[model samples]
Target: MWRCPLGLLLLLSLAGHVALGAKQGRVRRELAPGLHLRGIRDAGGRYCQEQDLCCRGRADDCALPYLGAICYCDLFCNRTVSDCCPDFWDFCLGVPPPFPPIQGCMHGGRIYPVLGTYWDNCNRCWQAGNHSAFWGMTLDEGIRYRLGTIRPSSLVMNMHEIYTVLNPGEVLPTAFEASEKWPNLIHEPLDQGNCAGSWAFSTAAVASDRVSIHSLGHMTPVLSPQNLLSCDTHQQQGCRGGRLDGAWWFLRRRGVVSDHCYPFSGRERDEAGPAPPCMMHSRAMGRGKRQATARCPNSHVNNNDIYQVTPVYRLGSNDKEIMKELMENGPVQALMEVHEDFFLYKGGIYSHTPVSLGRPERYRRHGTHSVKITGWGEETLPDGRTLKYWTAANSWGPAWGERGHFRIVRGVNECDIESFVLGVWGRVGMEDMGYH
Candidate 1:
């Protein structure tokens, strides 16, 4: 399986030779159903002269370790793969390459840069035409379609008023983390599975934190993303993806039940599907179907007042303002872009590093991912300049990215994270009723 049609190509590249055969023209072929190939002119595909690079699954043998995959020419080749590497899924799943490929990345003052590695089986598919499970499209396309398509929320908070009230530049603390302050109130990192509903999960998670913090731990209830996924369908798609702001709007008006009542079903499917029907608060209305009802019995009470976000407001593009909000209120929801390089991030403050031989843009599409911004900190640079970063709580489980959290370059709107931040005040179910 490690064998490839790259012997001739590698010899040519090594000898600094150009194609002289008739293998140079637009030839079409079908790799699988719905996956047609066109414009592949050469038998060796494309060539590059980079000595440090390697293909998706090729051997890399050089004195100094090489950088991650880079795109040299039309083909994403490295020194070891000879020339013309297959696509990620084809290379790994279709042919089962002979050797496993290891990639190199940089992080906080690490010299050798081999600090860690992870099992990237998330996109490994053996079935034909099923490359990465990211909505049957390239990684970038999936992200862009799910996140970049959503329109910004209509409700806007008065940034001037908020800054004036909070005093944005008021010598804020160097670091802050919501998990440390309200450890019990904050939920563990979640996994959304193959569904593109991080928007829903992140929104729900942040709302839960707000309710818990606002009520001083007396009303720490885990809100259900399932509730929003099934019930809130006004201006957004349910599981296929939705807008962060629109989700907040739904929470403000129609609130959600606890996870105990309706647990999340995000990881239940491999393909994107319509939101499942709300079953917890609904009763069977004949024909084996359930109809949604407002009231549902809780463990201690039959009362039926949906938990709500008093008001949802946007936190504009100000890092200090965002920090102040988190320090004062609680966690806030953020819609950030996920580039191809982000999936490779393991630890430390993350910044994008392009893999030139990979043609990353062609393989992965840009995606807008929603996460909860829990805190912020500043790392002093060697030149005495300060590098500010934001601590984000992800919904992809603790196994990924800094133990369910990631630190991204902040203050500069890295990944456009600071562009559309949102916050809200949650209403506890029994706080007003004097029920501790």
Candidate 2:
């Protein structure tokens, strides 16, 4: 199977030259599904650029350096004629190609325009009239439909004080991920869906990981965003949108249960009104502590343990400080500015898409969103430049991003990610681990 589309994949493409080169090619090849190659003057239906890309039988033991993935090429082994480039699925996978053959707007071979618009090589499918850049949203859905975190009225934190406490001089690795360090404790990202309550989802997510870490694996609970959505009503709007401060406030004061106890019901809730009714509630047991007063909504769990966290603290937009916090503590909640193009992110280090920049105001429209920043790292682009980025977990579920996580440029506050970072400690005590 081809790991990626067969292409020259030159260093120039790293500088956004892939599209330019594809336009110059004479032939096209459907190298891999969606991994279309406008080619370096090659076609999709043609053989590999090099005879070496073709190999006989399994590629693992083939010992070919230039060939990236297994592409069958032989006539003597199975007693049948075979070419690696032809019918990729029939020879290798033993199944027909998954997609039905459709008359595609042929590129390179000629500029064949199916409609008013022509396919741009290594570019997006374009059409006349209104179009959407974001995958699931309409072109005119505006920015508010999916994004839902209000930027803190003031992201201004005491940078001087924070730097002193975090100790700016600490030597940090070039990269780090809380998931790798903590393993199962770092919860997989969750989908916030139609509801814009990223404030709730991210808050709950960070709390979930921090608590699990602080407890040393004794209490790894997936805290409930639904718990906050319905009950944390002071200056909060549940699914429609809410404040990060308010979310942290609830996790500290009112507290919440596990997602198993109170699953998210806001995905399909009416955006015009309040969230679904609060399913779990708590009563103060004593000493300013609270206990769940009802059974888990999912009766099978037989648990209604209330999870609580400490008041949140801000991580000023210092890259080192943010990295130190994530390494020492756990995931932290970060407010990100999500533009329309952000919805179309498949993979790779994300900066604002170049096509969406400048011009009309709406083309650049964006909304604030809160995401969980789990780690940070740097990428070396072909241009010999090092780009640092933060690995952030979006609330859009495992299917939507790099398995529900995306990397934004780390320093210079790309999209305001580090502008207002917040961290909280899980209020774990002996009772949480069942000692009491």
Candidate 3:
């Protein structure tokens, strides 16, 4: 998603007004079947009514003309401005100039983008006052109309352009090997019953693995997600929803240990208790002794709290240098917006529809929390569709999908993601490694 040299405010202005007789050379190419270039005056005369030129009830009711003078019709004109602008279907059909690709999953002629397990269905697809599924545009028409011929550079591909060579055939180390020595490695079985803190569970598990590999020579004790979830210092909302930053803080203060002592209850505050002391030491002791060393701390750290949450900018933010550095250096967490028609999980490809950040409410509801981005994946859809995608480590438990993970397409006309806030956790020894 290229930033309009002009910002979103400027884009909104273009959508609201009729472009006067500009030079013919500046007009965008014809986008779809019903769309064509006409003089600004003619467009205004045809769309503008004596009262509200923008209005759609009557041909003369100009209050809100369909597609806002760019393309007007009785049925299309009646739709809201937002319904035609920044919408996946609208862009596919080229209703608005400079059309972009569509995101989310298409079902029954409408797009339904899923955020985690939640879904929002597009109402535009339904027929006038018809509740039945037969109402709206077919999937094919919507795709053709919104995702017209105008193709923009894929944000995912553009960001990873320098790493193309490495991307091919790249394989992420097993969860344990990725973060070897850390006691919190995800290898430990999760305690879903007592530790409903998905955020803490995932983060502690990943951090433990990473820290162990980087600091220790061996993959000793695997951290328990249940321990981090039930630990009092990191308590927030339950696993169904909780703060990502808070989860990391819990693990740093109270290093995860064996679940044998502290079991999971699938809910916060259930069977919770103080961590045991760390006592394992190598005295001609082998793997069993090392595993026993993962005992919990006698008492939780007093100041186990998230000092700050660093922002992880997505490809669209144009911070390639910074993003590249983080990906190469260590694990990076990010917040993203999910779209509908962009659903396809092939050999490994994950695609999403395109959506602009012009609307705040829509953007906020997309994805509120952050998750670690382990690596990237590429695959051809079962139907022979091809695309690149991101391999994200989500906060949801293993039962959610592929062990609590999902793939997001990288560069394709339709699968694009806007990333915000690359998240980082601050702990005693890692305070200096703050993200920008």
Highest-TM-score candidate: 2
Give per-residue lDDT, candidate 2, residue 278: 75
Top candidate (lDDT): 2
Q: Evaluate all candidate structures by whole-model CA lDDT and list the values in order.
A: 0.56, 0.64, 0.34
Candidate 2: Cα lDDT at 413: 88
Query: TM-score of predicted model 2?
Result: 0.68
Candidate 3: 10-residue stretch with minimal lDDT: 124-133
Overlapping backbone residue pairs in candidate 3 total: 63
lDDT tens digits, residue span 1-436, model 3: 1111111111111211233222222122223323222211112122222222232342322123332333332234333321222231232343543333223222333222222112244211101011111123333322222121111135522332222123555544222222222224334323232233445554554454344434332333344555544453333544434555455544433344544344343433322444433232212132212122333333342222211122222233333322343344444444443332221111223443333343344332222334455555455544566445556665434443355566654433222233332333222233223322
lDDT by residue (tens digit), candidate 1, 1-436? 0001111111111111111222222133112111112111122211222232233432222111112222122222222232233232233234432233222222222211111232233221111111122323434444533332253544432332244145555688899988898889888767766566787888889999998898888777888777877777777677677776678877776677776666676544444444577554544444333344754433453444355677677775788788888988999888787765465355667765433234333543456788899988878755567777889988766766787788988888888898878888886545344675
Q: Rank the candidates by TM-score, best first.
A: 2, 1, 3
lDDT of 1: 0.56
Error of 1 at 206 (Å): 1.0
Off by over 4 Å in 1: 1-161, 164-169, 267-274, 280-305, 355-361, 429-436
Q: Which ten-residue region of model 2 has the weakest summed lDDT?
A: 1-10
Q: Per-residue lDDT tens digits of candidate 2, residues 1-436?
A: 0011101110112111133211212122223223222222211332332333334553423221111222333322133212133334444344444433321122343211111233243222211211122233442343454667776654434322244155556579998999899999999988777777888899999999999999989999999888888888888877778898888878888899999888887565355664578778898987667989889888788878888888788776788888888899999888888865566555667766444343355545678898999998987755567878889899877766687888878788888887788888888788667788
Q: How far does residue 218 in candidate 2 sit from its true spot (Å)?
A: 0.9
